[model samples]
Target: MTGYTRASALGPITEFVETRGGSIERIFRRVDLPLALLDNPDLPLPLREQFKVLREAGREIGDPFFGAALGRVVSMKKLSAFGAWVSGAPTLAGAIDRSGRGLNRFLQTATVLRFQVSEAKARWSIEFLDPGKDGRFQNELLGVSYLIDGVRHYAGSGWTPTLIRSTCVGAEQAAALENVFQAPVLHDAPVSAVEFDTALLSATGPERKQPDFGAEPPIPPPVGLREEVAMLSTIALLEGSPRIDWVARKLDMSRRSLQRALDREGCSFSTVLEGLLKDRAVALLLAQKRSLTDIALHLGYSDSAHFSRAFRRWTGMPPSRYRS
Candidate 1:
């Protein structure tokens, strides 16, 4: 596993941007984003730029979870449609039942959906889908933050998550994820998750109400945000140094177009990829007890020396010195 989860909540980012007087056309041009994308709410924008846009204008959006801000505006269209088909049949539980979509039709870019459920608890997780190492935990935190708003909207109340769990262990403690979720966030236990108490399942469909939580403001609508994120994902996708062809295929862009996109974003593909690779290397070395040689292999270095040279170039020191 790449140890990543896909964040599909980005479907509404455009709308969020537009709402805040962010220039859609200027943003499109600025970000090297095509205006045609606005028509296709289901389109997957690039990931690197997406993170940049989110982090760049994050505070303005009144959301810490970049993806969640988008999810706040999205209605689970598939689930809503399915629920409407069985309208007023019985409780909200009956209306929704247990139908699941492999893709959460509600999200376009972020790839997440409700995968499973229990009698009282529904367990759904978004693959962080991070190429940079350790976005897993941050991504999970962002997802939960978004879910808080989402659950409240559908549940028609300020429904808090009963529990939270993560594989982050000591790291999650450093992040204080509980402050974001405002629920019991359990670390080093199992998978990252947000748990709803049993009664939420039975809430009727029509009975579902949106929360009083006012939506956040729009962030800067840079066109390149999605493209930036896509590049980041591509960098993360490659095991080590990646070829232009591989990145082009992953981004569904021609080599020339990819180059142009990077230029427009004021970045180069190689520069960005090198940064992410080094970042991942440093993160893995710091977070895990794995030996240096093992870390080198995981990063796709043939031997420790090669990785050491690259690591030194990326950082100022060899991996061992950094660890110490």
Candidate 2:
């Protein structure tokens, strides 16, 4: 899957920038992102663009430790559903395992979370599959900080990683990171990981009061061309209308090749895009109390009237009727 991240994932950075008197609109424009996109935390953002925004925001503010600093302020409440579920796990080990299964639900592509338990230590690592990208270091920092924050929420604020390793940091940034993590920070490592005492895995943590709805159903691992395209379309739809060529480029294939692949699956790109939009439209109508105009604009409609026509076409009823 070409993974996507929720726009809310940048909440800490957004708060940091705004507090520093930085213009978030200018930052969004610099990254070719719509300013209104951040309004809905659950909205999916292309992982590539998410990284670009982070890197640009950091560069604009001249803060080398931007990611790490942001991580410190990020709370479980800001992490959305995934964070809540992790906090509810009975032990630190359980949280790590649950996070592994649900990582894709949070980030749709280009990132991975793995948990390994050894006799001496338990290692939880996050790897950004795309290393050549601009914000690799910042992402690494952010990921590690997030893990630490989650652990502290349940394990007590005193918990710390036994060792921290990153593939992206340099000597200058290492000291700042070490101070934040309060653990040895190794730079230019093979993978970005946090190691902790194995004993801590079995240590009980405070129980979190999960909502009655419980955790989100685990997403099945995406496989094959159709699923890959569907995942990409879901991510693209969050920003605006999904484009076949854009999805093709994200999949690293030419437009013709992408069309041929869809043909083999007995579906076309337009069908996939329509299906995704309809699903998102229905979801927003039922789940959120947002006005029709806001929902329409979110789905990339020029206005509510256009959205109403599309909704009627999809469900044989206008969006307002469907909501009622």
Candidate 3:
């Protein structure tokens, strides 16, 4: 369910460049990115490169406010629009559902926020969903950390996740997860998720009114749900038990078309599949309660030995060692 694409972050990013009299080419060379990527907005680049590019550009102009302002353009701005949409919902949950639909209208880069609630607990997972299996764990974790930090920037300083999860493991990965969530992060969960007081999600926060973007040009129109769902489902497919062919069919596309859609969105099916296996293998291994052979079967690995090799490739440690 994931493809890497530029997914325009609005003219704010472009404006950031303009403000400094800098061109996008400057960022390409400065961040070691491919300039050809600019032609396709759906292609996702490095999150660290993204932040660094913006952070450095802002710093070069000596405006910390630019980073905060860019945040406003991308996600914080949408919270307000969503708040307006839900302003009259009878309950907080109604507002969350309403707001959830507009997620792409705000954050278009490597991210997903899934929301679910029941009588007992409310679950919302803010995932920095990566498309390929080709990112550093540290870089990916840092993106997640920045997202939470940015949300806290708009939400509150005290915000935290109930359960922190990662697609990687080992003492190093575990420590990064802990630092990001600022809580006891469990290493072996099926996904990166957070449980919270659903009530808080309902509360009237800063998201209630659209903020002016100063001088940034208008953003491109929002992409469709089919496109978003396809992208999401593909990323999820990569990170976990890759289902959602059913979901894609609903979009009136064959599995192959759906994959092409994903590729145009900057991802490939095979990459996501391997990422799912890597994530599952790591999580299963770290939990340690499962036997190696059982873990292999669970991950759809041919057998224990194959899973062991994959585990070693991803974590530089054997599943047996992780279990120990």
Candidate 4:
């Protein structure tokens, strides 16, 4: 499974396409995606569909640099919750670390951001654990853009990376990206990354006004089987396909023992796994951007027929009708 991404990630490209004499509806239709999903910027769209949309949009707009062009216009305000969490951090390094750790929460099962710190520089890179069939050019471009934009929010607009490296860009595309990033972009690098001075990590930005969600309270630690299972499930999903045996091994117990523990907690292993799958399925369907076949493969189903039957049992409706 490629997991999912917020719809706002596609905002800049959508706007760019629309402004350049392209129809948003036509683009979505061409990709077999629902146009209505665009209305909710915070909704989660399957990552695979995001790639398809960008690739199709590039073809539609007749520009090979469409992704890079779109990246130039993206701002942190467009990233929603992930942006908020990044913006609220106290320091540049803290923000980068927070974004890397919490990325899976906002993007569901995807965790492609990697951060490394040394005496001289801080390197942040994106290398998908599973690249899948589609190339990662657009995703890499958008990721670099988002990192630059988010860092600028804290490090000031004048901040630039020491260097930018991307695996997908060519000499021509790299030149265009250089104009946007205002720095040298190395084409055909080992990975897509931004290298920054380590000293800047401690630099502070203007104080952000905290939201009035509520008063702060003491935080409690996660305790019990449910929390453990949930945490393990998330790890399994992000790393690859989730399996009961793998989870049991992680827990250092036999599958029977794990099931008995969950049973004592008034839940079965299948029940918990099914619940997580159902939640993920609903999010994908509400986005209305992926076919049943794609969704099935994402959920680790061997085939769509089995996935359809399970989905029907879970929701009492077909996956297609559920989206409708």
Candidate 5:
């Protein structure tokens, strides 16, 4: 099942569309979203539906850069406690780390936010975990925009990213994005990201009073058995290869019962583990600095050759070739 995003995360949607002379009501109806969600900030909207709303609204407004434009005006405050928590971090790097961890906890699910540091640059990326058929071009741009905005909060209003990487923008759309981001953007990339110098990571924000967020919201529930299993397997992968028996034990159930539960959901532990491994492998490869042996062991492979074999089976290419 696809995960849910808090409606507040999309608080700017209605106004953003209407200001551009688009009927958000019609677009909402077309996507089966309730108009009431605009007023109900606490409600959870399906992540898939949220992606559709943005895509359709962009088309309806005849603004190919609609998502990127809307992202420019989006306030992090709309993210509720999640926003406050991230903003309160002392350093820019801490804020980025908190945003990534808090995303699945307080704001949304079925997404991955990564902050990776290399020699002199840091890559902050956002990826939708659900690989459904919905058009995510707009959502992807919006996500990258948010990452850039977060950096600006600490780097100051005049800061521009070193580079922006995107998976969706074509030649025609690149200029519009360049104007918005004030940075060179590379399209058709592996993932959407904001790449900047490591120096900005330690930038500090002014000391100011933070708002009373009351209490943090409860962590969002797992979307389904598959997602639940996937989450556990991900953590287990760090320790080594994830075993079904270990996962079942963590869930407080027998191995056979857990297998049956997954069977009813039309998936198995092996499939879930494979998917997690593949995602991790791809992400590590994108870093472009990790060696084959390090990447292999990190993903729980016994050796580089074993991982190379698996990579060939999964992508019809070896890891070295894929990384290149």
Candidate 6:
């Protein structure tokens, strides 16, 4: 199942490689990949090819923990649509759930994201459907680091996994992972995963006032009421009209019941709608690819002026200045 992934998956590492004194061009050429892949993040690269580049980058840079370093620097914004979509989730567990479901949607295929809980521990893991485990050490470490980061988003940045499990063996490799994760790493494991306390799963995410980038791809069916509201609201926003009643009807609940449920979770339909708007607005502005009138209309504003006013209220500046 060597499927495909976006070239943007390399964006974070591309810069990191250069900073570490590795020539990305040489690495790509050595791996038989096109140099243009770096220029276009949305371009599709064979998943195996991406793995090869990662291994080559670590080898050339002589950084045994290169993948771990790369993972630590991965920001949600750099993930494009996938990141934006995950950021909308209300809790750490919800975000992981979204990633497990939406990874194939916004990023790649032939991969499985697994979240499991046993007793007092929770494990989150990523695995390729492909059979061989031979050249995937770096990729697995990167995946592990990414999972840790997701937990850190809510559990606080200083959070560390209770344990790290990896397919990579050897004391040296285990030591490398230990250095990066600052936790005990079990080598020669059947799967690569991070284990943490089950209690952390309930950590609430930060209020999403502004999103770094956005794209409203269809969200998978969500598990929580808050997430369901967010999903329906995104759909309504794309239809150019966001209304709570429509979402309530879709959920087979009365509008008042939905509001009370959201209140219990300390969320409201208006808040969800505003966050979605801000996400889309910032994404479009950052793209520098559309007119204010067009963006206003797309966001269901009466005109650019009204949109500008709302943008100012959300942000400190007007749309034109913000874009500039």
Best by TM-score: 2
As for TM-score, the candidate ahead, 1 or 4, is 4
The TM-score of predicted model 2 comes to: 0.73
Lowest lDDT block of 10, candidate 4: 212-221
Best by lDDT: 5
**Candidate 2: lDDT of 217?**
40
Query: Which parts of model 3 are misplaced by more than 4 Å?
Result: 1-95, 109-112, 126-131, 136-155, 210-324
Q: In terms of lDDT, which candidate is stronger, 3 or 6?
A: 6
lDDT of 1 at 196: 75
Give the range of the ten consecutive residues with the poorest summed lDDT in model 1: 211-220
Model 5: per-residue lDDT, tens digit, 1-324? 456677675568788888878898899778654566677566555576688888888888887767788888885544677776677778898888788767886788888898888999999999887654465788888988888878888899888888899886486567668887778888888789999999998998654235444565644577677877786666456557888886776565799999999999999889888888888899999999899999998778889999999999989999899888
By TM-score, rank the candidates, best first. Answer: 2, 5, 6, 4, 1, 3
lDDT tens readout by residue for model 4, 1-324 = 335566666677788899888887888877655565666555545565677788878888887656667777877644655566666778887778777776676543454788888889888887655344353676667778778776777778888888899775479977877886789899999778988888888876564534221322212223567656665575455433577786776555799999899899999877888888888888988998988888888788888898889989999999888888
Query: How does each model score on lDDT?
Result: 0.52, 0.75, 0.51, 0.71, 0.78, 0.77
Candidate 1, after superposition: displacement of residue 135 in Å? 7.2
Q: Which ten residues in a row have the lowest lDDT in candidate 5?
A: 207-216
The TM-score values for the models, in the order shown, are 0.43, 0.73, 0.40, 0.63, 0.66, 0.63
List RMSD in Å for every model shown: 19.0, 4.5, 20.7, 11.0, 19.0, 15.5
Q: After superposition, how far is residue 276 of candidate 2 from its true place, in Å?
A: 4.9
Off by over 4 Å in 5: 207-216, 223-324
User: Candidate 1's residue-wise lDDT over 159-198, tens digit each?
Assistant: 6777766555676472565665556767785446667765
Flag the better candidate by lDDT, 1 or 4: 4
Model 3: what TM-score? Answer: 0.40
lDDT of 2 by residue, 69-174 (tens): 7777787534677777777878878778777777776544567888888888878888877534767677778888888776676567877888888775588677
- Give candidate 4 misplaced runs (Cα > 4 Å): 169-172, 207-324
* Comparison by lDDT, 4 against 6, better one: 6
